[model samples]
Target chain A: MSEIVVTHVPHKRSIPFGQEAVGALSIIALGAIGYFLYPDDLAFLTRLIGIAFLVLSLDLVTGYCGVATLGHAAQFGVGAYAAGIACVRGITDPVALLAVGVFAGTIMGLISGALITRFRGLPQLVLSIAVGQLVAALANKLSWLTGGSDGLSGITPGKVFGIFNFDMYSRTAFLFSLGVLVIVFVLLQRFVRSPFGLMCRGIKDDDLRARMIGVSIYPRLVVMYGVAGAVAGIGGALTAISTGVVGLDSVSFERSAEVLVMLVLGGAGHLWGALAGTVIFMIFEHIVAAANPFHWMTLVGLLLILIVVFAPRGLIEPVLSLASRFKRKGEAA
Target chain B: MTNLLEARGVSCSFGGLHVTRDVNFKLTAGDRVALIGPNGAGKTTLVNLITGDIAPSEGQFFMGGDEITGLSIPDRVRRGLVRTFQTTRLFANLTVADNVALAIMQRKRITRRFFSSSTELPEVRAEWSEILSHLGLAKLAYRKVVELAYGQQRLIELAIGLALHPKVLLLDEPAAGVPHDEAPKILEAINRLPSDIAVLMIEHDMDLVFKFARRVLVLAAGRLIFEGSPDEVTADHEVRRAYLGSYADARRAT
Candidate 1:
């Protein structure tokens, strides 16, 4: 018999330049900048991190898998509610709460994914919107369980690793959220580069061709939705942990639409774009809303219009292209 | 040898119109069969039925003695039944290497691995490299499919088919839309496929068909009218009337 040998080829990079590296570096750099820039307002930064998870999760389903969804906030809400309810019932180890959120979000994702993946294009979008509306309505109707419109309160999360207490100053919460974001960012980077990720990309491009190539499209899409759910769920869990509340707003149609806008503002397919979009849109909105008070919506609308018309791919497209071009020049020199 | 693929009285109808009617054929290992007919002859419909793109209304398909009529498109593919589209369907935005690599990974059942990069896998790399090099596509591996010439894209489809390690390969007008000069390259690649795999080619070009097929199956208006050797195909009265028409008449006059 011929000697069977398996050797791995090292991923060699003469220059440490690629989207994965850029995305990771950007996340860390932004996290550091946020900590420094908003030292007193870590709560705002923490909230942004929570929303960032929702955007990233949306990207996985909508961007990577070519799953069209407007009601992605449903998964996020389910995660938030799950974590909040868990905390009230006394399962408040912050990490364990996150796991609960992830689990709840995944189940919600699978259910929504099963229903939504049954249709294509307009129907898929419509079904997703319907699912979102249905979930929000359910949350509203179940006043006893969800605290109705008043929101669920009295959520007291335990310490981080039984050490760092969740303080009133919000420093610990910010750092915890940032840490989880970075870890998630790294894993998602690997996920989108994986064979499964590539398969999703192929499915996104041409589902017919994907099927012809022997891919069972439905199951893969559902699993991807589940993954997206997990991501979004953790974000929801973080929101509950930091804010100590889960309200109707957590599972609202408005919230769902807002996350979609953030994703669009960033660019949907790129992970960094999702994160960057959330940061920019939230920060911009926060500042503008503070400055204008009443007319802030107009400015946000104008910014969106301008971005859509000029940089249709999202605001991050130009930056990524520029980075690639700069790398090419560096190589030439 | 037991037939690799056998279709028995397979018929498909959409609404009231029958697209494929009572089609039957058998493909054993190492068979080179050309399927030829007019534009609406249901040649592709027959292929679709075999590949499970559309289920047969009144027939059964067997692969190595097992019925596969109820199988999904991907299920048929997993069973080594592969087809290239009439209009070259590739992941246009992806690099040619990636397009081929997707198939290689699928064949190896490693498409679900999320931790490692797909391209960096040694076995996947080995298989795709072999396939791309085999098709003279190694130079264009990094180039996006959208940037390649139409002929080159068709070759990539063949590369994808080969990567799947197919037992039965279907070519749905493999040379369609390819420039006349570049069409033969596709035929050459098809010719170079592994001898163990059976191939069924649908071609409008008679010259290419004559060169590629050892046995030929002719379809006309949803029925298989003729099945014979390449030489005998030209002499058949029915095939001449239905498919060859003026060419056969002109030969008769000469």
Candidate 2:
């Protein structure tokens, strides 16, 4: 009786050990794998990491906040192009390139967010797609700066703190991108559990009730859009730095739609799902397309249909729920 | 400041039809005023006007004597003008405690804090415990709003409104789907609110309204038909015909 334990009223564990440990272990494992097994394909894997970041960004707005969008690649494109431009303009420091990416993504996110969040449902989806296409078109037409369809090249990001130079083997790029992913994941984990995050969830659940409870949904969503943009920007800039080129493909409508598919395939609401979905989709695409380019898309489409019909909450959520159910049952016993 | 909430010449119309017209109303602190009207009498429209869910076509609304004519719903709520829904709009996916704690967090101005645990905080827990207990919902705190019985959901709605620390609470059907025996608990919870906070309840249940309201204002055809003590409301011929009718005789017999 003296050793009786009283948990908190809301039953939220003080230390989010499971999520935090998962975040840490997942990234550390990714780093270890990239260091060992994927040494030859580091460049392709690094590029995939950038796409994962975009998916995570999309998840923040689409999955967590319930903002309907398909043009997230617009923000990603701006980030990549901004970093490429910085490299061309001689702001060669990798850190500065990352900052430029963040800045570019944030600006686009705010501009599009204000317009899109004012509408609901179908209008939002259309507006977001329109924004993505507009950016992509601009990138193609601005030949002098963006280098037309050939993409902006000669982008050489300097060392990590001027010590470890980006090499041909692609070791530094992988580490830098992994480090950024870990920091962003940890921050986002804190965010989704925070009061603001809960309010965002509240807004997603019922915007009317959220308004009745004194939540100004528009501004909250706009800020979320900006944060998501900044994270996605990191991905874009990392892509430019690693690949040494920036293509209009970064902001293409195809990129926008495909990232959404990735989010849905991996799971959207959770940050880890972004990584899981990206790795799975890219690896699957690489293998399948290498064998048959045209037919590979059909398989991907089939996989998406299955996920939509079966794992409607996204792929990982079903697993998480199952684990929790088992835990609940164990407690009862 | 004597009148915590007031409506002056408030009228609203849609297209060519007038839903509510030029109704002046006021509520003082600690007052329990019930707004009663039959279907299509603009009971909901008038409440929406007061809560800023819709703009009154004419006249103004005031909170503590300050004209809040064109404020948004959230802005009105931040000034301590909170309201519960007719259909019970708790966050269906969240726990009952989360629903109530969110309002408290908004009141505390810590709704933006990213790293802090709202549930783990001692003060938040204490507040949830008190409010949940007051509404007989302490045991159901962990239950999701979607999983609760309809009656329990209704009580959770009231608990959330109370958690906002409202100077004036507008309860829209506090027992719409509640069981007959559970209604007393709803009325009892209303009786237990802090005396400083005024309440304007919109209920169709004559017995519950008659028991809870110190004063009752009746609306019919979008007009203020009667405003008096419960006894006067029970005796008024116009209220009896337009809104109450046979229910007045039943209330009077009690």
Task: Provide DockQ values for all models, in the order shown.
Answer: 0.52, 0.50
Deviating ranges (above 4 Å) for candidate 1 = A1-22, A325-333, B249-254
lDDT of 1 by residue, A77-170 (tens): 9999999999999998999999999999999999999999988999999999999999999998998888989999999999999999999979
- List CA RMSD, all candidates: 3.6, 3.2
Model 1 chain B, poorest ten-residue lDDT window? Answer: B245-254
Model 1 lDDT at residue B31: 100
TM-score of each: 0.94, 0.95
Please state the interface RMSD for every predicted structure, separated by commas. Answer: 5.1, 4.5
Global lDDT of each model? Answer: 0.89, 0.87
> In candidate 2, what are the lDDT values of residues B168-203, reduced to their tens digit?
999998989999999988888888788988999999
Best by lDDT: 1
Q: List the residue pairs that clash in candidate 2.
A: B240-B245
Instruction: Provide the lDDT at B45 for model 1.
Output: 85
Q: List the residue pairs that clash in candidate 1.
A: none
Residue A93, model 1: Cα distance from true site in angstroms:
2.0
